[model samples]
Target: MVLFDRILLAVYSLFFTVVFILFSAVMLGWPVPLFLLKDIFYPGRPEIFWPLMVILILVGGRLFWSSLHKPRGRHVVLTESALGEIKVSLHAIEDLVEKVAAQINGVREVTSQLFAVPQGVGIRIKASVTPDVNVPAVSVEVQNLVKERVFEVTGLSVSNIRVTIESISAKKPRVE
Candidate 1:
């Protein structure tokens, strides 16, 4: 699936680039190669305008079709049964983990990054906890929250959850 996706993206990119170069040539009134303009239809002599419009329309149509057929998001899995390996976007998984961690009690802030490994997601979570919060307990809570949220949202199991307590806020200094 990953290979197929890359191939499709490459094809799409190539098509767009060719279209862009051709359009630029047309706009600048530069003569286009006869072979490149063979398939294009023009009422009279092949004017740059008509061919340009045709290329634009074709590119637009391809984009629309690809968008319709494309996966909803990077992290989405297309099939349940895996004949081969599946790749999920680390960014999407990280965003979900951060969201989950933010919901935990005493969590002031949460930031996370994900690393891709075979078979599962590896996550690193950095959290700011309340001054009075227990660091170890908070770490555990964050780990569990991240795991559940990522699994629920992305359908990907987390293999590792490394939690770091960055800083704890101290109580406001008493007024003199």
Candidate 2:
């Protein structure tokens, strides 16, 4: 998350924490410092209080909804010729990456994720390879293969490709 988002979340969390403590104190009949917010709830000032409530509700509601509804990743605009436009989803790119990675010789299992970058898209791949495979060489191969195939198919430049070798699996040899 960005710095602004972190700060906003911290403020929201602090506000809720204080509110919870105050309410719990009141319910438990414990000594409470209600004076801290006494001016905020001035009974004589409906004009000020109502507007504050409205503003708080609107802003809080918006923030609540935003937290629940995360933003979707951006799509790649492949073509914008005189005739029309073509957009490709990040999921499709991820699928392509997985397929390409699977085609590599020593890869045992593979999954891919994509992120939008300024020039085009960035790819992150996680895979399990055969136990005997060379780690550095295979990693480079995976990266190159994914980048080449994605660009060949989608015509979108891959900003970068990262390959993480999650595990090395050994398959038992069959005895005849």
Candidate 3:
């Protein structure tokens, strides 16, 4: 968000916080301006009320509309030949990366994100490893696995595979 949006949200939050505290004080029998505050909302004051309502609605509508707008994912150009052009979804690559990484012995949970690069596509894999597992070994295996599988399936060159060990899970003994 831009600076104006940040300021607006901050002001909006502060306004609600003050309202909450004021209402709490009133409920506690404090000498609050309950009648005066209510008078500010009197139906006779259209001149002041309408402009404030319109401003609130406009700002609120913009925020709501922006929240609904989803960003489009990047697509990789697989091939451009005389026959035709072929492209693959970055989502597909991420799915493939997650699946391949999850199959590795040390990984407990896997998540992947993709980005476009000058050389090719970049894959970032975040994994939760099992306790007592070798991190460097598992990371290397995951990196190699993702690179090979993604290229094999999508025919897109992988610029880099960055493996992040997000967390390590507690070890559980195998029943078998």
Candidate 4:
């Protein structure tokens, strides 16, 4: 979404919420809110009134459009399934990479993103490793392990695995 659109949405939501609250209060016999918002409820200037009304209606419609039409995530297709075609979400594959990579001795934390390549997936991993371990060795181990495990579980080849040592964490691993 564009910055301007986001700002408009935020403004719309905030004012809408406040208006609803004021309306509810008026309904419950408190007329103070109604008097406070009287000018907005019954605008005096047609030139300002028409443009503001149009903008509000357009923003409301845009909000509805956004709620109904959300972007879908990419998935890998597995054509070799015995029963039927299978689709695996790239997000799930990314989670798999994170889990596999974080199991390595030196890795303190892991985050990953996956891309669907031809007949396979490519992974980019961001890892926080222990301050005491060899970074190069740990990165290599994470890459190999993630590749192997993804293949073992999904039966899809991993085209590439790029591991970045994002941080050398001084703290010990968290227990789960």
Candidate 5:
């Protein structure tokens, strides 16, 4: 998330955490917290009462909504056979791509991401390779090999494969 969202979540979490801890202390009959706190809601003016009620209502509503929310999983369905459709998780595809890409000669490190597209799946690969390797040839090889392998293994057509040579490894290939 962006900076503001992270900050807001942190602030909201901290506020609730502190309030709960103090509440537990009060329930346990801790003298320090009980003495220091003032009763802000005890038969007071409507200004404080209504605004605090609104804030609490909003907080409760947010909590209830969050409790019912479910995170969306990244998956795609392909109708391959007469039985039914096969569902493939994008994360599993990413792992397969990473393993295949890292097995390439002269590649020091490999990472991949898979996205489901209308045409098919789109793969983005980031790799660190040895400095002596030809970047253009390796990039093309990576793309072709990844595309073929994914389709061969998963029966899913790959719309495209993007390779980003993120860095060149300083270590040179050793002579046998």
Candidate 6:
């Protein structure tokens, strides 16, 4: 693909180079425009057609060149045989996971990071649990919640769910 793109870019560059040369020649007092509009409808002096054709060619070439070189759009292809072995957009999946995890009990704040890998989606959840909540139990609940929600929404399995506990607060302050 890269090689093909390079070849296309070279061809486009050559075409533009030719057009530029022709435009420069016209500006240098060449009577090429007379020949272009001599037989066409609305025959007139070559002066008007010369600059118009030059502008059209320049603009058209630029548009074509850019379209050929620039990235087109997101292209995702998944076959039935490889249906369970694909990775989709992680950002979208993460949004769904966060929404579901927040609804779970004892979940203070849910911050998730997701990555699209060959096997499937890899999830890393950074959740702040309430001081009174069990850290291990909450982590397990979050993992399950995220896995279920991500699968339901995206139809892809969660490869790995890593939960990190940032901090734990005391339920009550001790008095002296």
Best by TM-score: 3
Better of 4 and 5 by lDDT: 4
Compute each candidate's TM-score over C-alphas.
0.48, 0.66, 0.69, 0.65, 0.63, 0.46
lDDT of 2 by residue, 93-156 (tens): 8888988888888886789898767876788899988878898899999888888888899997
User: By summed lDDT, which 10 consecutive residues of candidate 3 come out lowest?
Assistant: 33-42
lDDT of 2 at 79: 91
Off by over 4 Å in 5: 1-72, 80-82, 171-176
Better of 3 and 6 by lDDT: 3
Candidate 6 per-residue lDDT, tens place, 38-82, comes to 433232646666665776577567657766676543323233464
Candidate 4 stretches greater than 4 Å from native = 1-48, 64-73, 80-83, 116-120
True lDDT of residue 159, candidate 1:
85
Model 3 Cα lDDT, one tens digit per residue, 1-176: 65777688778778668777777887888766566546655667888768867887888877676667675756777889999989877788788888899899979778899877788678888989998889999999998888888778987778888889999988543557
How many clashes in each candidate? 0, 0, 0, 0, 0, 0
CA lDDT, candidate 4, residue 144:
87
Considering only N, C-alpha and C atoms within 3 Å, which residue pairs clash in candidate 5?
Answer: none
Question: Comparing 1 and 2 by TM-score, which wins?
Answer: 2
- Model 4 vs. true fold: TM: 0.65
Pairs that collide in candidate 1 are none
Per-model CA lDDT versus the true structure = 0.73, 0.80, 0.80, 0.83, 0.80, 0.69
lDDT of 1 by residue, 1-176 (tens): 35655666678688678767887887778766434655553456567657767766776676666667856555545345657646666666677788788788788667998876686668888878887778999899888877887777667688899998888966442467
Clash pairs (backbone) in predicted model 6: none
Q: Write the per-residue lDDT of candidate 4 for residues 16-98, one digit (tens) a residue.
A: 89989999999999989987767666677677677879989999999788767766877778665778878888888888888
